[model samples]
Each structure stands twice: as structure tokens, then as C-alpha cells.
Target: MTTPRYKRILLKLSGEALMGDQGFGISPSMIKYVAREIRSITDIGCEVAVVVGGGNIFRGIAASSYNMDRASADHMGMLATVINSLALQDALEHSGVQTRVQTAISMHEVAEPYILRRAVRHLEKGRVVIFAAGTGNPYFTTDTAAVLRAQEIHAEMLMKATKVDGLYDSDPAINENAAFIKHISYMSVLERQLKVMDMTAISLAMDNDLPLVVFNLSDEGSMLRVVCGESVGSRIDNVTDGKNRVDRTAAVSESYH
Candidate 1:
């Protein structure tokens, strides 16, 4: 049994990651896969907290571009996150992992209101806590919410699970020559305007010196490997050891299913 590098971590999942091969909505298989991945780490005694995005169902920013009220669109988006959160909780429970759903916005009928101490307590008792509703406010992405919750819970690291292997200089889909970054500095990420996360989230993590790992969730056991500190993805921190450049030769492609 390998000792985990971080006792506690915040795992951030994009709504898009739940869509699988479908164009919209959550894929049952994908959600289950995510649950199992989380369970793998939790079984090793690593406390887990999740922050999932809602872009698969609704994107407030995209709506706002088409004459919709930004706040209203964002509110809808937040609700979408809650939906995902509930689905995730159900799947986690089915996987034999005790789970809790806490929403930033008050909605006691379904989940507990986002109470910092209570959420921490749940994690301390070996329960996986899924944070939903995205900060209970508009204009903030789930990325920011993940960072905020991680800080409040004192997570050792923020692990962002994505479809791709790691951070890249440009969108790999569009740019054939895009380079894969193995490691980077938060400030450099901001300067380059990388899309690993929103600027606000990156800035907050940088300010608090929170380490971030961007890895491919589609790869089996990738999450567990990351928890064991196995260099499974690109890492972003405050260090600048001249190792921030991308490795154009390194690329990984794996099927989600």
C-alpha cells in the first residue's frame, strides 16, 4: 500500500467531462466511472471533496451572449450544477461510498446548505462531500468555487480532472502543434492566459499558494496515481525553475469509455 501524498484534496470536474460521447446531458457510464475513480482514492483513506461544473446542461456565459440576463442565466447554470451534484451523490452512494451534497444556495429540501464546519466534519468522518450551486452567486465559475471550498477545508491540493492529459500551450483540438506542459507557474499561466482554469480561480490559488494538478480523468486509475504523487499530469505552482516550457513531443490520447 502506497502512502498518499495528500491526505485531503478537492477534485474539480467539468460538466463537459460528464457528457461522454453525447452532445448534451450526463452519461450514466461516465458518472459511474467518476464515482469509482473517487472511490479508489477514498479507499486509501484520502479524504475527497468534489466540485462539478454544469456546462453540460447549461452555460450561463453562453446564454448571456444571446440577450439573456447574465444573472438569470447564471442562476440557471447554478441549478444545473446542483442537478449534477445530486446525480453524483447517488452514484457515489451506489458505489458504496458514503456521500453528502451541500449547496451554496439554501435548499434544505434536497441537500444541506453549504456549512463550512459541517462539510469539513463530513470529510473528517470519511465521507465524500459534493459541493454544488457554485458559490451561491453569479459571475463566478465552478473553478473559483472549487478553490474557495478547498481553501476553507484546508485541502492539500486541488486536482482538476479533465478529458485531456494535462495543460497545453493551446487547444490541442485546434492546434496540431500545441505543446503539452508538464509543469508550470501560476503567474505564467495568467500571463499566457491558459484555459486550465478561469483567471480568477488561478489568481486565488496563486495568492494562497495552493498547488494544482490538471490530469485526464478518462484514464483509468489516473486520479489514484495523482493522489499517490505519481506525476500523472501537469502541475501548477508558484515555482519558476525554468521547467515551465511545454514538451511538444509528449502527448497522450485515451478513450473515455
Candidate 2:
């Protein structure tokens, strides 16, 4: 059996990833696909915890931009995360992976309240723990919540699942001339004002020196490859040896598959 790179990891999934080809809301097929991907890692004895966003259902920042109260909008966004969490829980359970949903906001009826010790216990028992509700506070994003939970659980690494194969100098979707960055320092990301993560989340991860891997979720076996220590995504950390060096040549020549 191939040994996994990290014993424990935190995966951050954007709510938009759950939508698949749909215009809005959760897509059952996407959730099931994610469940299978997660199960692959667990089958190899890797402990996994996830933080899912709710942008597909509701985006607090966008709402606030349209004249809604910021706090109320954020709270509503948190609830959207809860809904995503439940859907994920159901999918995981159906896939035969034991799962638990922990909410930052207290809602005992739907899930257990966020308790550090219990969450650790659940992972120790081989169950995947899904954190929802975005830190139970207003003005915070799921990105920040993922970092906080990862630090609290002492995860070996943080994995961010995105649509892009890796981090690029510019949006690869529109700019074909963008350069691919294989590795970057957290400070470089912040200084360059990259969209890898929100400033608060990047700052928090930087302060704690938590390594983050951003990869394409749509690619089959991408998560498994990442867990197995393959160069499956762009990595961000404190390493300064070759930080901020863009790979324009690799961008055109290398294939993620």
C-alpha cells in the first residue's frame, strides 16, 4: 500500500463546487462525487476534516453590496453553509463513510455543537468531520473558518479544492498567457494580492505556518494524489527558497493528468 503524506488534513470546498453544471443550489451528483473522493483518502487510513462554503446558496458579501446589513447577510451565509454541510453528511453516509457534522453556531437539532475534544475523538475513530457555519460569527468567511479549524485540530496540511488546476499569475480562464506558480510563500501571496484566499484567512494561516495545497477538484483522483504527496497542486507555506518564481514554461508544457 502507498503511504499517505499527511496523517490528517483539512479540505476546504467552496459552495460553488457543489453546484456542478446547475445554475444554483446543490447538485446531488457533485456531492456524491465529492463523497467518493473523500472515501478514497479515508480508505488509505488518512484522517480528513472538511469545511464547505455556501456561496452557491447565498453570498453575504454580495448581499451586503446590494444594501443588506452586513451582519445579517453574513449570518444568512453561515446558515447556507449548514445546509451544504447536511447535504454533504448525507452523501458521505450513503457512500459508507462514517461522518459527523459540527457546527460553529449552536444548532443542536441538526448537528452537534463545535467541541474541539469531541471533533478530535471523531477523527481518531476514523470518521470524517465536516465543519460548517463559518466560525459562528459575522464578517468571517468559510476560508477563515477552515484555517481556524485546521489549526485547532493540528492538521498536517490544509487542502483547498478549486476549479483551477493550481495558482496562476492571472486568471487562467481569461488570460491564456498567465504563469503557473508551483510553490509560493504565504507572504508572497498576500503581497502579490493573489486570490488564493481571503486576506484574513491567508494571514491566519501564515501566522501559524500551516501549509496549504490548492488543487482542481473537478479532476478525478486529484485529492488522492495530493494526499499521497504528488505534486498535484500549488503549495503555499513559509518556504522561501524559490518563492514567487513563475513557471511560464511549465505552464505550457506540464499536464496535471
Candidate 3:
């Protein structure tokens, strides 16, 4: 297998990944497992940063089905990330990794506010910094926050750890015959509206030339696979203002098959 191409990577993990097989909230065993994977990456010489989503506990926008105010709902979502970040910090520490949880919204009791320089300093010192609170504002998903933070920290790539292995032409879970694209362009992603991520997030990543490595976090060694430059999932990078570019040296296919 080919090695991972990135030196400093910002991993964007959805809260649902922490849920494991549970219906809601985090599973201790699962968190520990994920933390171990991250530890493996850091053990190699790569600086790892994380932007965790709070979807498992709450997604303010998705909660519109209940008619909650969009801003209030988003704030609640931010709070949920704080909870998740704390859990992850504890888990990482348990695995012998020093971590710091930084939030956009100030919660001095639990973590430091999201200060870009401070977070970068932590990474420089070899500490895993968990960015929480989704940009410290409402009406934005954590996906956008991930792009913004990843860009600000000058992360070489964004390792998007999702339930799915990679971007697909159709819903792989629902459509058995869906095919995964080994490589795709930004125009293709938007022209098709593939729903890999929001336009704002993708645009930001595109402008900054930050690659998005979409992979499955549920697997045992996916995180290491991403760090080691192995063929594990789909990578989005604008070759010429592109969106998601697959690694040419590795098996860059999605698991929709």
C-alpha cells in the first residue's frame, strides 16, 4: 500500500462515528477505538488536528422538523459538540495522548475558546487540538467550520471520517448498484450536486487548495490508512480548481460496491 500524502492533517469526524452501533450519544468502547487510531497517526510524525461534528446528539438544522429557531437550534448543536469534545479529550488522554479541546463559544469550565494561534501552538507542541462549537455561531454546520478552521491552520488536507467509505454517484446504502468514483472534479461535484458536502465548505476547500480525504471511520484501520497514504477512500483536491481528486498512486475507489 502507498503511504499517506499529508504531513499535517485536520481530521473532521462526525459525532455519529462515535455512536458506534448505538442509537444515540457516544459509546466509550468506540471512542477509545477511534482515539487509538488517531494515536497511531500521530506516532508517525504527522501533526493531527480534529474538527468534530455534534450530529449524533443534535443537528440544529436537521431539527427543523420540530420547528426550532434556526439560530437557537445551531447554538444547541454547538453545545453538543462541547460534550463530544470533552468525551474525546478524556478518551485520548486515556490512550496516553495529550489533547486540548477548544471551542468557538466560551465554556471556560470545560475548554479554551477557539483561538487559532493557540490551537496551532498546541499542534506545534505535539498536542491534539479538538476544535468544537462550529465557528462559535449559528446557521452554519460543522462542515463549514471544518473548512474554515482547516484553512486557517494551513492544514495540508482535511481527513473527513464518515460512516461511508467515500463519495458515491448514488446512495450506496440504499442503492445496491451505486458506483463510487475513483476520482472526481469540483465542477462535477457541484454540477451533479452529489451532496458530499455543502457548497460553502467545498468552495472554501477549493479556494484554499485543501484536499478532502473522505474515508470510513467505522473500520479498524481507516484512520491509519489515511495517514499512511494507503488506498482507503476518496480524496477531493482541485487539480485545476478541482473539488475531490483521487490519489493516482493508490487504489482510490469508494466502497459503494
Best by lDDT: 1
- For all predicted structures, in order, the TM-scores are 0.96, 0.95, 0.90
> lDDT per residue, candidate 1, 1-257, as tens digits?
76898999999999999998899999999999999999999999999999999999999999999999999999999999999999999999999999999999999999999999999999999999999999999999999999999999999999999888889888776666778898899999999999989999999999999999999988899999999989888899987675586778544443221
- Residue 18, model 2, lDDT: 96
Error of 1 at 48 (Å): 0.4
Any runs in candidate 2 off by more than 4 Å, and if so which? 249-257
Give the least accurate 10-residue stretch of model 3, judged by summed lDDT.
248-257
Model 1 alpha-carbon drift over 4 Å, by segment: 250-257
Clashing pairs in model 1? none
**Which candidate ranks first by TM-score, i.e. highest?**
1
Residue 141 shift from truth in candidate 3, angstroms? 0.6
TM-score-based ranking: 1, 2, 3
lDDT of 2 by residue, 167-246 (tens): 88777656668788888999889988888889999999999999999998989999999999999879999976854656
Clashing pairs in 3: 3-228, 3-229, 4-228, 4-229, 186-243, 236-244, 236-245, 237-245, 238-242
